[model samples]
Target: MAEAARLLAQLIAIPSPSGAEGEILAFLEGWLRARGFPVAAFPVPGHPWPNLVVNPQPRPRLLIDVHVDTVPPQGGAGPVGPVERDGMLYGLGSADAKGGLVAVLLAVEALGAGQLADSPITLALTVDEENRGRGAEALARGCRPEMVVAVEPTGLTIGVAEAGTLELALEVRGRAAHGSVVEGGRNAIREALGLLRDLEALPVMRAEHPRIGQGAVTPLFIQGGERALVIPERCLLHLDLRWLPGIPRDRFLQEIAGVLARYPVAWEIVDLSAPFETPEEAPLVQAMARALETVGLPAIQSGMPSWTDAEPFARFGAQAVVFGPGDLSLAHTPAEHIALAEILQAARVFQHLLEAFARP
Candidate 1:
């Protein structure tokens, strides 16, 4: 537990914001190499940042997936080394995933040499999860794992499903004219606002999953007009759409198209990730439940409202679930932190799960 805290602190000290994960990746690679763990590093195509696979055994029975990158710091605050206070470890990535990463490393280290050799467990430390999930996509294309445990800050609960993600860019065009000539041109920004409002009220927003709840559409960013003096010729709006498992991607797209057709706007999907769900009866899920029970934690099952690497792993034919310590609500916030007790408990549960899965 102490070693895990030390490792968590060291990791939190490094700044690995989305596109700048090179330094942290290098540090992780060196850490694995120093411990004699067989490590494979794959650079994201066209990017210098690398995703690392440790103990890359063929047809591994279990794969532990965790991202190394974090959302850029908020309020101009950067990665300050972890600080211990009120029984918690506070830092930029502490609760989000670094805590889970530490627990995984400790659990793997706890396994006996013979067990590690026979179990064929692999750890995928991915980059770009906060952005496009490129690293996970690359791993899914390159390796095959029978089952995957995607580590996230789930407050020690097991996440059986996760919401899908869709990003759309909407461009509304109108004739540009002098601002003083109100009747001569349409304001593209004004035209886009109505469409945005309709999109926000789409029926899909009411669609619900038992655990994950209803889907949502958010207008994340918008831009228009070259200058305040001129009417805008074009208005660009970015939409972030999150959906549940049973919702078909085409249906979502068609619905969006239907709304866009109501107005004069051109739109394109910038990115999309499918939702993923694993049966509660899956062997990996059951094992994780028992491990949690063994560690004196409740075997709670729920859905992850946010998009995760689990989606890509599932698409690659691996049954995957999200599990780890810390609270999801605390992630990506200024007060981000993880309980020390949760970290210790999570390490124990992971160790137990690995040992049980390794048993013939």
Candidate 2:
């Protein structure tokens, strides 16, 4: 428990905000190597955000994956310098993901110490789950896991499905005119508002998934117009679409096209991630449930509304489950923290699974 707490604290102290996870990657590499695990670093493009691959021998029967990168720290929490209080560890990435990563490593260490090294378990820690899922995407394009368990903060629940993400960049173009002749020119802001109205009227959003339930869309940001003296010529609106499994990317794009055509506007999908789900009764999910139950934690299958890297695995047809410590609510908040008890619980649960699968 101490080791896990220490490791998590050190990791959070490193400031691995998304797009800048190199330092944390190196830290994890050295930490795992010191424990006799072989570490390999996968090169990430455009930034030092490398992914750490920790492999121990005996052929991995289970693959544990976690994201090392976190959402950019809002100014509220200056730096996640570890703080321990009331048996909880508080920091920036504490709940969001660093804690989960710590639990995986600790579990692997425990299994190794018990001479259960024969169990097939590989820890693939990725970068960029907060912004773009490039790290997870890279893994999907490269290796295949027999059973994938994404160790995100699930409060120790067995996660079966996750909502996917789509980022829309809508641009409204209008004829710019001097402020004195504002009435003579079309205002892009007005055009953009019309487009938003159309989007708000979309009934395509289903309220629930078969297992996950209810998808949502939110207009995250908007920007346009340099000065009040002139009629704005352009406005850009960014929409975040949280979709369920049944919605196809093409269909979503079609709907966007249909909405934009009614106005003098152009739009493009700046980023897209498809919704993914695995059946609750899937073999991989069953294995995870069994593992959790063996560790004395009653396992109940659940779903998350937020997006995770697990979607990419589902897209590639890998039966994946999200399981780990920490609460989803604490992920990026100023009060971000993970209960020490949960960390210990998660480590033991993972160790139990390793022992169970090591035999056969």
Candidate 3:
């Protein structure tokens, strides 16, 4: 537990926000290598950032996914320095994932060579999960593990499902005309407002999942005017849509197209990530439930409120679940901190899981 906390503090002290994970990746590579673990660094194609895979033995039964990058520090603070007080560890990335990463590292270390020889485990400490998730995407493209446990701040519960993300841009076009003669000109901004209202009435927005509840549609950005004196001829609306697991991408796209067909606006999908879900009866999920019970914790199951790297792995035929310590609400906040006790407890749970899954 002390060692895990120490490593967690070290990781939090180093700022590894989204695109700038080089330093932390270098530190982890050296640290893992020095500890006698085989480390492989896969550079993210064109980017300087690299995804570090540790102890990637062939055809491993399980792969542990941990992302090193965190969201940029907000709330007027530049970067967080590690501080421990009242049995809590405070800093950026502390609750978000550094604590979970430390627990995974300690769990692997506890398994040792003898258990690992029997189990054959792989740990993928990837980069850019907070932004694009390109690191996990790359790893999934090359390797197919039997099962994956994506370590994220889940308050020590198991995430059986996660919502997918879709980003769309709606371009509303209108005829430009002088502000004095408004009768002849169609105002794109006004048209955009009407479209937005229609979107709110779409039945797809109410699509429900038992765990995560209804999906959401939110207008994130809108721009229409270039000058104050002229009627705007163009308007752009960016919409963020969250969908439930098992919803087909094409079906959702068709629904959006149906809505847009009623208007004279151009539309395009900017980004899409499929939703993920692992069956409760799967071997990995059953083993994790037992592990949590063995560690004196409830075998609770829930849905991840947001998208995670688990989606990519699940899409590529690997059964994946999200499990870790700390409250996700604390993540990316000025008061980001995790209970030291939860970190230790999570380590114990992970160790139990490793042993349970290793048994043939």
Which 10 consecutive positions of candidate 3 have the poorest summed lDDT? 111-120
lDDT string for model 2 (1-360, tens) is 687778888888898888888788888778777877778776656555667876633225567789988887777744465898888898898988888887777878877733544456667888887877888787766766667888888889888878777778888899899878978888898888888777756655645686676656687888988757888999888888777777777787677678878888787878777777777777777777888888788887777777787877767777788888999987778888999889988888887776666665
Model 2 clash pairs are 60-120, 60-121, 61-120, 207-214, 208-214, 209-213, 209-214
lDDT of 1: 0.86
RMSD of 1: 2.1
Deviation from native of the Cα of residue 317 in model 1, angstroms: 1.6
Q: Which scores higher on lDDT, 2 or 3?
A: 3
List ranges where model 3 is wrong by over 4 Å: 75-79, 175-184, 226-229
Compare candidates 2 and 3 on TM-score and give the better one: 3
RMSD of each: 2.1, 2.7, 2.4
For all candidates, the clash counts are 0, 7, 0
lDDT of each: 0.86, 0.78, 0.85
Cα lDDT tens digits, model 1, 300-341, are 999999888888779988889999999999899888899888
lDDT of 3 by residue, 1-360 (tens): 577778999999899998999889888888876767778887676556889987666556788898999998787753485988888888999988999988887887787745665666788998899988889888888778889999999999999999888889889988788888898788899888888777666666678898778878888899988766778889999998887887787887777778788777998888788888889999888988999999899999988878777888899888899999999998988889998899999999999988776666
TM-score per model over all chains: 0.92, 0.89, 0.91
